[model samples]
Target: MKIKKILVDSLQEAIDITKSTYGDKATIMSTKIVKAKKWLFFSTNKLEVTIGIADSEDFQKEFSKEKELYSEIENIKSTLKDVVEVVKSTKQEQKTPPPITQVQPQNNEDFSLRAMNLATKLINAGVDQDIARKILEDSCGFDITIGRLDLKYEDDYQSLIEGLSKNISLKAINFSKNILSILALVGPTGVGKTTTIAKLAYMYKSQGFRTGVITLDSYRTGAVQQLQSYVSLLEMPLRVADTPTRLRECVGELSSLDIIFIDTAGRSQYDSVRLKELKHYLENVPSLEIALTVSTTTDERIILDSARRFSELGISSIIFTKLDETLYPGCVLNACIKANLPVSFLTFGQKVPNDIELANYENLANILLRGLS
Candidate 1:
């Protein structure tokens, strides 16, 4: 098997290039729009498409084996590097003599320095300053014994960091007694709510559940069509409801289905009139779980504000999208912690059923510490 990343001006060009290079048998792995630097002060946008092809059965087996071995080796290397860093730090600390002080240096200056360093690390990772400070205060004690910033307190510092990273809340979907569940997604424009709904529909359908999708996003151009593309491919039913009455009717019709997902038009969080209209549609719906979808690549302030304003719609959980577009994952933790909501799902790329995952606490913590790059 062979893989190649092709850059082109448009999706059509990418498709043509892949077909010309690898023939019809090639599989498109992912597609993303990125800015390419054409000059020092200017940049142009281009489409990046990763495509793969399998030459033969033997080659596929060889490729799979080599990929697995390479992944294992990389994991081993990362673990060894971390171990080496800890060993080196310990050795350096032993070699240097501790500064002599009558009272063991449990002063405000030492505590302030340590807190500032931790806050700086968090802020550099895209976390809000207030959120970072709150995390530090919540995770570490203010006792004099905890004020030392030396080798003797190295383990304590490490534990404090780990505890702070675990502050994110994670929630899982609950399938009701009759095997019928209703989930609605709401968010701002271009945050991938439609695509995420498609992904969730595909995931549930693949699990042998009778799934149905309904969209109330008829206002957005091509929104229904985008979702229809996926539903049509999966042979699932899709209903477009433009009003509360239509939505209720659609829900009634899909009652026999095991799982039903509702997609809504993206509205600005500041648009209270439209938000109230949306609430009217969902307020009476029984057992409906609303998930507020937000992009991880967005600014931390916007994320927090979106979470706050969307809470008016009674958002039950958060669904973070576009994780693959950003290197800093700390915004996810910051948003969730600030909103006091649990994360339900994470969408990383454009692939249906492939890029979405159930939120895992430890996996997200690792990503926050070591970015996707």
Candidate 2:
């Protein structure tokens, strides 16, 4: 077996380097925290991971061997059991009294049940329990008096949507008015920021706006080349910004264009150094607008944290990406409400220009109340 140790600032970075270096057969042997050079005037803890892999083809081939039908069936059964367990756990969570603050009358059983049911739906859709309860109390709270209930629209889909959307802040970008605008997208890794940037660039280019894209994702393998491919197909200008100086030059070169899109490297939300580095790079660009691209598939708490930190970098609006990958799309509402920022766009798929749209906050509420529309 061949063993190697990798030292990186974050565990995710170590795992990524391992996967790209040794592929599937690599086995992580051990991990430990190590003191790293001081950063941001303080010492940051870094992780050192030790990994091992079989050195011989014969040993490696053992893993590549196909499983028997019996083994496959057993694996399928195990997976199905896991899914059932998850469903049961979720249902149990739904039944429990939520830990959210209650503002309405506690004595009214009927009112409490109705409010709890609505809050449960939001929770199932990945909305934070506290925010969901607030929505129930503030927007959807219906009184069941001795004779009449004012919430006749409770059964209506449109009303539910309007209620949830009203609880959060939403902003729509006017692409036509973004003429001569330079926008930058920053987010965590694997959130489809690059593809979304390409989609926006193409959409504007097709609309007869001279749209251009500049990528600062120089560290990722083939990042520049991928965006360059789209630039060639669209016959639009593409620039690579490796330094703040180069970024300024790229902006000047594309200054006459109707829209300029800056594509930034995806960094872990915990990696504050790189986030600061991103800010230092873009702070010079004139009238620059920053958008945070986040994924609905991400854990709700992580989405909240990501939004908070990225918002520190002056992200005016958010773009929720990979909407098609998650059933619980409430991350949009959760981030917007918690971070107190407006969502500007939504990308559902990998298709260029077609999969992205101006974000619909009501659609989020609609999906939470009912299924996808």
Candidate 3:
């Protein structure tokens, strides 16, 4: 395998460069948008391409790819429009949800009836056609039938279930009483972990829960202070712990509180020692739920790796932030679902509380719709 570098201005040019270099052998190893210089970085076994308008000659003697880069800009614009159009078409098809009833097996009376019922419910729920077909197909072979009825649609059946089922899931969660459970926010730095925690604390507090904020983020200066500011703004108490023993003590002190949210200092998931240390502390807080916070704007591989690493910490759910910054949120959904973790909330804006939404089937569907659109 050889590594090459091609500097370009847009995603399309990056793709083109990859195709030009490796043809059918190329695979997208990773990608990221460098915010400071505003460039797209595409990495592969074959090459690492920096596509930007920035004047840096890692690519050329002038350190500038092109001062007259508008030509590339025009090419990018045209390509982006096409990409958007394709996504729009896909979303439209997803909306229609192709019919699967005609394909149902007719010979098995009992099985067919049950399958039809499931199919009908899925169709009504606005599940996409392909998902419904797979559900129907996969479930037909099961021996005991009634249990299958109650189980929520499996992944293969998801796209086929009726929209009503999703809405029901959403409504059920919305109307369900707020359980007094601890939310432990764990993830890397600058991923909006603090802001996301503030949102959840505010949400529960507004609903009249005796919510308390605890931070084991003593390593970062102003960490406790920042949380304290939000704590004051929310009119809640914020406790700081300098070590795992201290964090355990903090949890013990908050034993009387209805809900105790523990915010650990952000560290890369791959930072084994720190992650294990944090996990060690949480292990002492029996019955506490770890809510992994991930920035939606991150590369998909990073999200997957982070989730995998934190799984050792026993993450119960996911909370994604920076949703507003990403044009497509499919990656967030994909990461969570792949990790087999339920999404708890999505933070779209920088606002303290207003930007967060409790994740449910419908909320996810809606977000997916918006992204594909």
Top model by lDDT, which number? 1
TM-score for each predicted model, relative to the true structure: 0.62, 0.65, 0.55
Considering summed lDDT, which 10 consecutive residues are worst modelled in model 3? 167-176
Question: lDDT scores for all predictions?
Answer: 0.79, 0.78, 0.67
Model 3, span 226-285: residue lDDT tens: 889889999987898887788777877876667878888889887999887887888877
For candidate 2, the 10 contiguous residues with the lowest summed lDDT are 143-152
TM-score: the better of candidates 2 and 3: 2
Candidate 1 lDDT tens digits, 1-373: 6888888899888888878877756878899999997797889999899988877885678779999999999999999999999999998986755442322323336444655566566667677766665555544444444544332234335534555655767888966435678999998888999999999998888888899999988887788888899999989999999888988899999898888999999989889898899999888776689999999888878888888888988998999999889877778877888789999999889988799999975566455555565
Q: Which stretches of candidate 3 lie over 4 Å from their true place?
A: 1-180
Model 3 residue 191 CA deviation in Å: 1.2
Number of clashing residue pairs, candidate 2: 0
CA lDDT, candidate 3, residue 229: 88
Count of clashes, each model:
0, 0, 15
* Best-to-worst ranking by lDDT: 1, 2, 3
